[model samples]
Target: MQFLPVVQRIVADRWPWPRSFPRSLSMVRSLVLGVMSLFGSVAVAADWPGFRGTGDSVATGQYPTKWTATEGIAWTVNLPGYGQSAPVIWGGTVYVTAVDGAQREKGFVLALDAKTGKEQWRHALEPTQKAKWSETVSRAAPTPCADADGVYCFFEGGNLLALTHAGKVRWERSLVRDYGEFQGGHGVGSSPAQTADTLFILIDDRGPSYLLAVEKQTGKTRWKTDREARGGWSSPVVATRNGKPEIIASSAGTIIGYAADSGKPLWKLDNVVGNTIPSASVSGDRILFGGGTSRSKDAPPMGAKGNGCLRLIDADGKPGYESVWSAKLGISNYATPLAYQQVAYFVNQVGIVTAHDLQSGQELFAERIDGPCWASMIGAGDYVYFFGKDGTTSVLKAGKEFEQIASNPLWAAKSKPKSAGNESRPGAGSEYGAGETVYGVAAADGAFFVRTGTRLFRIGQ
Candidate 1:
């Protein structure tokens, strides 16, 4: 009976309890020392802070490399509206964007429990102007960036708002009123990035474009620099070389870097064209970017069309920068390539997955999946998770050879999709959305979050 009470005290001491709760001295120390063993598998080493995880989109925690709709799914929740912006995870919370209502003007920012997929807070944003959303340009297409204090979201029609973790609005800004109309065939997809105290935003479109850095708390402009980039949906990334800040972006036929502190031009690589959709991924000093038209209709060769490159950035504030390698081997139009295992894996619009050597730019191997991919790939360690437009998630080994581990379908089993077609083969149509579409994906908090038209799924143990 004495040992029984002591055991009970130990169990109670394992977690926080009221003052009246008893604790055994040895038991508390034992439980405290075993913290990592108790929760290591369920913990995320770092936050998925922005459009891409920590700006570059590479993950360190163990995420699910394979899962199906009715198989390894942890939880699923319906969203207010449809979007293509990937989810961002911070601590125990996951944040995503959407637009509600018939007019589709109701922009919303949602906070959910990262582990349970439970709804935490839903903050709806008021748009400055009525949004005109299309299949190509989604209303809530730009993924939000989050920090320790707040989450910042930008919607189509240039509506921007920052919300605290508890769903309180901190500040709001209008990109449309501040910068003018977003004139283009498609709308904005430039998500926000952050330095220590400044938030960096790049708006590159047919209308006036600029890169603006704003103070985090008040949303006041720190620096505003004009940009010549027209019609790009890629998000900006923040990195540092030799303790200085560099905000890098790939858009409008160039890979440009800006001084994060003063919003001044640091360097640029011109002659890069057709890379507009997916945000560039980074690995240490190198940035990998790729995108282009997958379907040109009846029109044939418009010169040699290929949009992909691996460019190394000079982090030391040096003026010179060079491409580590350039090739048409692994160029993705919408889906962003994931850099893993020292190779950049690019998935073209029609499901052509290519892995190119990061150091040499030589084509390693290519494979065809069951569908086209709209969302960018996210990697954790040796495994990469690829989301297809038809709600399929293909798990692959991040190796030189093409090795597919699993082909997991996302939609309900009742929904049937045709076998993936070959883009190079004749009589094949590579149109997108073959079934229920999966638009965005993220990996954090020991789980993978997938975004469908109107739902989000958390996949892990």
Candidate 2:
């Protein structure tokens, strides 16, 4: 029955979602625009493949807005335990995930070498339900989904594997051994939503929530649904409308859509409020979604008309979706609200970066960067990266006015890098004891990986 306070980072901005799910921008103009840049250009390797990359976290090349902590980095790697998950690439390899015991009962996946981060294979996993490691629980927090047929990962104790880009496993599932025990204490941060053979997965916990799909070549299940216990941690996107594919799902009070091929439902929009931790973003046919500040002041309005935009309307012919614009201020708390190109960024949680106008939500420019962003802001070519949790990243200018351009930093408070100790629990780690923060961000070939819960860096140029 706990509807808030899951990880409670001091409170303030409470919502900001954008699990985008916008697929083909023609694969970002055929593998990232004028191809790579930051110092020597011509590297060309694009493939971020999941949790926001390509689904509209936007990436079209030209990374590195000025580095620090060792000059534009290029390779860092250290992880073996802590993970807030997010580091997936495909085509030169680079998958990630972690969670060591203290009761997390181990889980890993690794597989680096995207041009020399090395490692190459790890696998591990085995947590049918151990749950005890903390920092408010959710260690390996969901963010895997590669393609060219492989990498799936999902841990939060329920496990869900799938390896194979040479790491070899190809199938594994546990969801607490076939669905049960996930009653919320903030475990599962939901992340897995493919299409090219299904894979969805949502699970809003409190007990009994659901939204599966599976079958990406034998993991088998294909359809589930259930939902309505609602605790919220958002993640499940994949849009398309009018030509088929669906599955959006903005948590908490509701924003459903399902039917990515038989999971059915279709459309819904109910009450909604402070949107359970950011997760809904797409651009072209719009979609966007936002929410924050709701510890229940009777809970209903989340400001600026509850931050909005949704459009997938066919009406008389059935298939629907329509809110069509609302942000005159924008709201979001755990990062995840960026539309790019047509502009629409919101940052809230103490860094206030609003910029709306992705087709008429007006309010262009709120300003205040240098922090706040639990990883969810990356729009390549012509910049738009915010990354800061405690490592600074800023660089904005996707245009509509709020130009920041560069803030960079990533390590240098005495070199940062400490949270990796668990050796049978002696002192464990994390709770912010040195992991420094910066939870996740990714970019392809030309580099910019940045994930910290014990390091992952890459940056570039």
Candidate 1 residue runs with Cα over 4 Å from true position: 1-46, 293-317, 414-435
> For candidate 2, lDDT tens digit of each residue in 29-87?
53232122110112224778777764667776577788776566766767787788789
CA lDDT, every prediction? 0.66, 0.72
What's the TM for model 2? 0.34
Top-TM-score structure, candidate number: 1
lDDT of 1 by residue, 1-461 (tens): 00011111111100122123327777555444433322222334557777766655667767766665566777767677666677888777989887766556788888888877678878876677665555544557778877777788877657777788899999998978887877754556667876656777788877788898887788878889998847677778765443355788877667787877787787877756566666666665567777564333455344333455544444565644666666666767666667776777887656888888766788998889776677767777678777776777788887788888888876545433244321111111112233456767777767777776666777776
Show the colliding residue pairs in model 2. Answer: 15-292, 15-332, 15-333, 16-332, 16-333, 17-278, 17-279, 18-280, 19-280, 20-281
